[model samples]
Target chain A: MVSATPTRERVLAILDTVKDPEIPVISVVELGVVRDVECGPDGVTVVITPTYSGCPAMKAMEDDIIAALDAEGIGGARVRTVFAPAWTTDWIPDGAREKLRAWGIAPPGAAHDDPPVQLRRAGRVRCPFCGAGDTTLRSEFGSTACKATHYCNSCAQPFEEFKAI
Target chain B: MSNRFFEYLLRLGDDRLVLGHRLSEWCGHGPILEEDIAMANIALDLIGQANLLLLKAASVENAGRDADALAYLRDAREYRNALIAELPRGDFAFTIARQFLFSAWALRQWEALASCRDADLAGIAARAVKESRYHVRHSAEWLVRLGDGTEESHARAQDALDELWRYTGELFLTDAIERELAHEGLAADPSAFRSAWQKDVDDVVARATLRLPAVEHWQQGGRTGLHTEHLGRMLAEMQVLPRTYPGARW
Candidate 1:
């Protein structure tokens, strides 16, 4: 039986059902974009952050949060965005990373905050399709802001890398 | 209300907005498919940052004006963007050169602002610091490539750098508004990071084999709402839809 009021856990569980609009395989909570969830007498407040500053998915995610809560009869829900510690791809947990790999997306590695910018980002990204280490970055910028395009030489398949930061 | 803070925010927001619009012009017209995507993505980031900054500015003004209103409704004369940002996107080399110069300065600017006493500004700046690092790397890499690519590419890159040098001075121009904010530790002082910016830019230019031009006369006035006659034309195209049907939504 459902409780009379939405608890923090309840709101969080609902949010877990809300998948990222860009990558539908992982939920927003799994992606760690949902910072905090609060439920009070007024209503529930879903505090979220953007994966990228200009990620178009942010609006969709916000709307999706509201819709998900509204569907559960949680009224007067509010969505707030806070950018303090800055979003990093590292926030995506190990379970979520495995899901991303299964979804044919190469999850990001450690997001080094202080690395000097390089002409070409160094390192080998294993192809998510065939688990091949031979891959070349086709473009640092990809179909989306948070992604980069890579060509797998071993499998001869094109893949997307969720960029590290 | 701190009028100076509002104006300062506007300056920061307008700079990104104008430059983002200029970059977006190359959406489909890029030299190549990858370059096209890259510019558009960068444009998205800049526009996103501008929107955030402008939203904060609107709240500070407490005038019921939203980011869109402040962005599309304001006249060119009312804009606070520096002249360098308002300049038209010239050639690919020119674009890359300007980007390198600007991003070098901006990366440091965001780094300094990350420590701002104002929590809101600091948060925005902190996020921006990460993005700006990418911007600097991307533009600097291109600058080096273009400068060393071939005779024609090198010459063009050098020419662009020389032509854009005069406008660079305005980026470091500070006034009473900025001075007060800096004193309060709520804002970054441009002069404080000037040397670091110069060193970073010089390093990239030298790597590219491009010589930095010495400006006999530094261009100014964009900070004071005096644009270089280019912002109005861009705004006309940008604001036309919003003006034609007020309150229009996509």
Candidate 2:
């Protein structure tokens, strides 16, 4: 028999186990697209808003969310999408940023506090490999939708930067 | 509460779907590897936008036909895509011209749509505006490059502008449906966006050293389910599998 943990606590616990496919250090909870979590007698419904619609990891993330919840006996949970107040980089947890850097992926830069009339210059990203702030962007798009390919001059390594989606 | 909002949304969705299908035709035949990938990515983005807009439109219409049915099973005449989207992507210049004009107009329209009275429409609009903004920027960047690249490229780019200019007027004109929706605050007042779109395109054209084609006797009636011959061929390719095997899932 499984232990009867409180619904909200159980859901939160399940979410903690849902890791990002590319970078294993951070979970979906840390990524912060999982906007609302509702638990009730019927089941749990995890309302997740994707960082980008074209992000390929969304399917894997959905499967992970379901599996994690099911492992805790929270079966029959419906994962719905809510796009209102569309996602921004501000939602990523502080700890996850460190984890991404530790895992050799440059974390996203901070979100602009104010909205500017003109397009701002692209953010400067530090190289995760050598911790150099002098990396040059090779391509705005990389292997994945959420990442940009950059070459670190100091480290002499071509690495992917987790672009703010 | 207005049916016009649903109508407006379907028009937007259909335009994306039609154009996306046209672009997808070049999956393996793109001029270069990078271009092929870029076009494919843009196609995917447009198709995804179509899905969101159509699904939301269906939900609001309370129609039994969901987005899949609307996308895969609609007849050619039943589609309400703009003439511009249905026009063939003749060359790189033609495709870029279409992208430039469409993306510029879409960015302005989506900005207005983000504040729609309907929450669902507003939600989709908010998400889509970001994507369209990127699309516009990408196309605008390319426009400047190709328009000023070489004599041949510049000439071709100018010719594309001349060819596609007629279709630009259809995007901003409002029908009874749009007018009603605008009154309800459920849809963007397209008329209000005309100057903004013009100014945006003017800047791009000025930078590209290309002349803006005059809007002479703009073609209308696309919003009323009328479309060019290209739309029929497009629908045939896009709808074949779904129509042949109804209720099919992948």
Candidate 3:
């Protein structure tokens, strides 16, 4: 008899339905938090990477993954977190940036290659609200560790920028 | 699984836990909203690191105790954090100076640990190094600003340095556990990072136009589980809910 076990693709498809608790607009897969899905004889393992080392949303994301898997009748699904080759904003899926912008959160800009001094000078982060480049950083940390708070001089609107780490 | 390794892990984990708690005290009390958010972010980072380190320590001990048990249940004397970490959070200048000193030392230690033989530790260290770099930059920048900003700010920053300087010697003091782990390639020698820490700290202080306090008496003993009176109060507040409602879930 052939086993009716869920395939890795099916598991991933199920995960696509799981939204990040903090950012409901993005699924874990689109955010690159879902690192891998492996199926084995004994069980299925879902590997994840946290966007920030201190992200409080990681536990919620993990629980959501497990729940999503179980809802699909996928038993013995385990979640594993890895830290090496640490998660980067670059891992964010293509077109997700535009989605993030549409959702009112500014997408992360390119990773900085400059020294700390140069990096401290506010980079041109186009405002999601006003599409203006005259935004200034109010704080390196925002409401979450993964974001930076910025204010657009043009629109006079305060926004959170997903910091590239 | 070695006792020495277990002790070493506790030392590192406890330092992060205590300092994280101290920083968390500034949650809603920051002088400004931006600083408030930054302090909370750094606190969260430190707490997250403590969770990982304590979890690793539990696994190494092979004991039934887990991270929560190790963190929230431990008595004051059972903690192995540095005395500097347990000291009360003073004014904003004091907090910034304390963070600058600790982050400077921790950044060097993490850099060395990233190359250690233990893969798990190296991975943790590698991840922590990135965060610590940002932490050091933040604290150092604050130091420069506070030192050069105004007469009052400069005096306050210098006073904070003087008061906190004595406790810093404990960071470089090595014991048998550290020596054994260092010899085994599982841990980095604390003494090895001292000069680097000193240079980095001195550079920041110099740029801030602040002078380092003269070395007089050094305070120690937190690594051996002897902390000041402050840690007990802090832990009492920190562990109350966990102890009161065992198995409480958020």
Best by TM-score: 1
User: Which of the two candidates, 2 or 3, achieves a greater lDDT against the reference?
Assistant: 3
Best by DockQ: 1
In model 2, pairs of residues that clash are none
Model 1, position B30: C-alpha lDDT score: 95
* TM accuracy, model 1: 0.97
TM-score values for chain B across all models? 0.98, 0.95, 0.98
**Best lDDT goes to which candidate?**
1
Query: lDDT of model 3 at residue A44?
Result: 86
In the range A1-165, model 2's lDDT, one tens digit per residue, is 254534676687779888988778888888886888887666678998867655668778988898888776777677898878877767777788888888877888875432211222366788887888887866555556566668899989988777664
lDDT (0 to 1) per candidate: 0.89, 0.79, 0.87
Q: What would the per-residue lDDT of candidate 3 be over residues A5-71, giving only the tens digit for each residue?
A: 6798999999999998878888999999888988988788999876766788999999989988887
Worst 10 residues of 2 chain B by lDDT: B32-41
DockQ for all candidate structures vs. native: 0.69, 0.39, 0.49
- Tell me the tens digit of each residue's lDDT in model 2 across B62-157: 869899988988787788888999887799888988998998888778789889888877877777676676577667777888898999999999
User: Which regions in candidate 2 have their CA more than 4 angstroms from the true location?
Assistant: A1-5, A22-25, A54-56, A102-104, A113-123, A153-156
The global Cα lDDT (0 to 1) of model 1 is 0.89
Which residue window of length 10 is worst by lDDT in model 1 chain B?
A: B129-138
Task: Give the clashing pairs for model 1.
Answer: none
